[model samples]
Target: MKYYVGIDIGGMTIKGIVLDPEGKALCEDVAVTGSERGGDAMCDVIAELVNNMLSKCGVKKKDIAIGVGCPGVIDSKNGVLVFSGNLNLRDYPLAARLHERLDVPVSITNDANAAALGEAKFGAGKNYKNRILVTLGTGVGGGIIIDGKLFEGYKSAGAEIGHMVIERHGDVCTCGRRGCFEAYCSATALVRRTRRQMEDNPRSAMWTKYTSETANGKTAFDFYHDDIDAKEVVDWYIKYLACGLANLANIFRPEIIMLGGGVSEQGDNLTVPVQTYVDKELFGGTSYAPVKIVKASLGSKAGAYGAAALVMKD
Candidate 1:
């Protein structure tokens, strides 16, 4: 059976996984990214990681192809990482360099896109022909899968869904935009809202368990059932999240939209409400085309698994 090596490069640690054509993981490992050491050093670390995985799995170099999911802008067509602020890499030919080291075919794409593909092939989106993975973390990151393939529009820079303006002139986003989806629907946004609510409502049940500084994405959810103030925060979060999801649903009309990241851990508490709002806001209504909002099953492994999927031939 042919094997594929998938590498997910992050600022802290680089995760790697070996997978078969059937999406079974043969081996999984991680190494420090050492990105501060420069792009070449990061490549060395990834090469070592691939070698270690191959050794452990008894897979020959010639029998495996390598796929990489990296943060920042990537020129996937040329296997070049155009820019990665997190990795301090720019105009780096990552795929070419790794291919030279291991003498195998290598492919690369933006990390978020890879995660979407991973879900499509092996995780939450596996059964759907069209799906999107929306990760509500520090920032809202997402990937689009259309017709069972990744849709990296216009040289792989187009899938930056977080920057989509869901609320024009509302809140400031890290991308310097006002009212972007990330500015409202991310976990960071949720924490900010939770803290603000606690500060405004001194008697909020959230304050019983967390101070303003300790308020997190789960803070409001924790007390929503019993606290009016906490429930307000949750309602606000779900409203904005549904707005963004509805915009995406109206555009792509995917079979499902999978929610990932820390906030998604709330499971039904998150999906149930957001689904209601999205269904209400759907352009042509839900009867013709329904979009199911589900939690991602792979958790942290989606990126690495998606990277491996890059090399798989259907």
Candidate 2:
């Protein structure tokens, strides 16, 4: 059977997948990116992962098309990573560099864009023509898909809904911007908010779970079904995130919006409240829009699968 390979490149982890031409995953492998070493080290690690996956799958190199899903602003047309904050890379010719080390053709895309492609083609977006994707992790990252294809925009950072300003002088974000959606809705944002509330009262169940002794520690997500403080934080988080969703709904009217990452781990607690906010902010007659909100079906693998899809496109 013909095969394809997809690699999800992140700050600290690299996930590799071997897929049948039909898109079924036949083999999966992973390795640490050890990103502190930066560009040259990342290249070697990726090459080794590809070779390892190929060997284990018993697939010849020439038979497969490969895709690499990478983080940051990417110039997909030229196969360059304009910037990757986590990896501290700028204007790196990743595809060209990898091609020189491997014989097969390699295609590349931004990580968020890949998730949009993966979801639009195979996940909750399968039935939608236009969709918005948000991943609520350390920071909120987003993508826009129109008619089942990722939209990278002319500047390469298009559909970066997380950076959309929600407050003119609100919380500071990692990007040093005030009031970006990411400063309010990301997993880390949730934690920080919850921690601040918890500080006022350490006896709450959420704080008790981790305490000055436990291993796992209290998290922003605990409020979902548990502690009152955590619940308060979650309520506000849903509100902040909903503002972004509402903006998308009123502006683009996508068929659906899919949420991923750790904040999504709250499941219905996260989605149900966000829906409530959307109900309030949506333009009059929004019920007719049919823009449903959903959790991502692909999880972390979406990145790798999306990368693989780059090579799979006819």
Candidate 3:
């Protein structure tokens, strides 16, 4: 029997998993990322994680391949992490270093793209040939899968969907762009909007439970049924979110768009309205190509699961 190793490199923790070709996980473990020590240090920690998983599963290194999901601009073709601000890496030969340590084939891609592939292969998108994952966290990140393969355009840098402008000359994004999808659609954006609404309406029910500094993505949703201000904030958030999803639907038009990350925890409360808006605004209507909006099932393990899928053979 053959096995595969998947590593998800995060700022605080590096998660690793061992899986069979059928996508059944055999073992899982995590290690400190120690990214502040640099890329080489990170590689060592990953190698140790791989070894730990292999040992737990009683699988030989020769019987397995390795794949990594990392946060950064990756040259997937070259197996190099081109840049990662959070990881503090630049032009790092990630796959090569891992290959040297483990003596096996290794592959890598942007973490968001990896999560998309994971969902496509085994999570919400498993039944669809084409799908897109929109993760609403600190920022809006996404991955595209076309015909069951990742579409990492132009040296694996093109799928930075968060940077796509949804509102012209609107709020400024961390990427230095105004009106980007991330500026309006992320959990952070939701929290910001919620806080702004609470500040603007001091008598709002939202302030009964949260202060401007304590407001979060769920604050408005919590008060939506009772408070006018909260309802307006949620409605405003959904409008921008729908705009972004509609833009993606018009361009890629995938069979389904999976929502991931913190805000997605709202589940049907979020998907139902967003679905209605997207269907209404989708190009040429939804009869010919209706897009389904659903929440990603994998949650935090998506990146690692998708990384394992990366090394699985057909």
User: Largest lDDT belongs to which candidate?
Assistant: 1
> What would you estimate as the lDDT of candidate 1?
0.93
Residue 96 lDDT in model 3?
Answer: 99
C-alpha displacement of 36 in model 2, angstroms?
3.8
Across 1-314, the per-residue lDDT of candidate 1 in tens digits comes to 38988999988999999997677999999999999999888889999999999999899998999889999999999999999889988999998899888899999999999899898889998889999999999899989999988999888889788999988889999999899999998999999999988999998878788999988999999998999999999999999999999999999999999999999999999999999999999998989999999999999999999999999997
lDDT of 2: 0.81
CA-lDDT, candidates in order: 0.93, 0.81, 0.92
**Candidate 2 residue lDDT tens string, 257-311:** 9998876766776788788788788887565776788998899888888788777
Candidate 3 residue pairs that clash: none
At residue 296, candidate 3 shows an lDDT of: 99
**How high is each candidate's TM-score?**
0.99, 0.90, 0.99
Task: Spell out the clash pairs found in candidate 1.
Answer: none
lDDT by residue (tens digit), candidate 3, 153-252: 9878898889999889899999998999999999999998898888888999998898888899999999989999999999999999999999998999
Clashing residue pairs, backbone N/CA/C < 3 A, model 2: 223-230
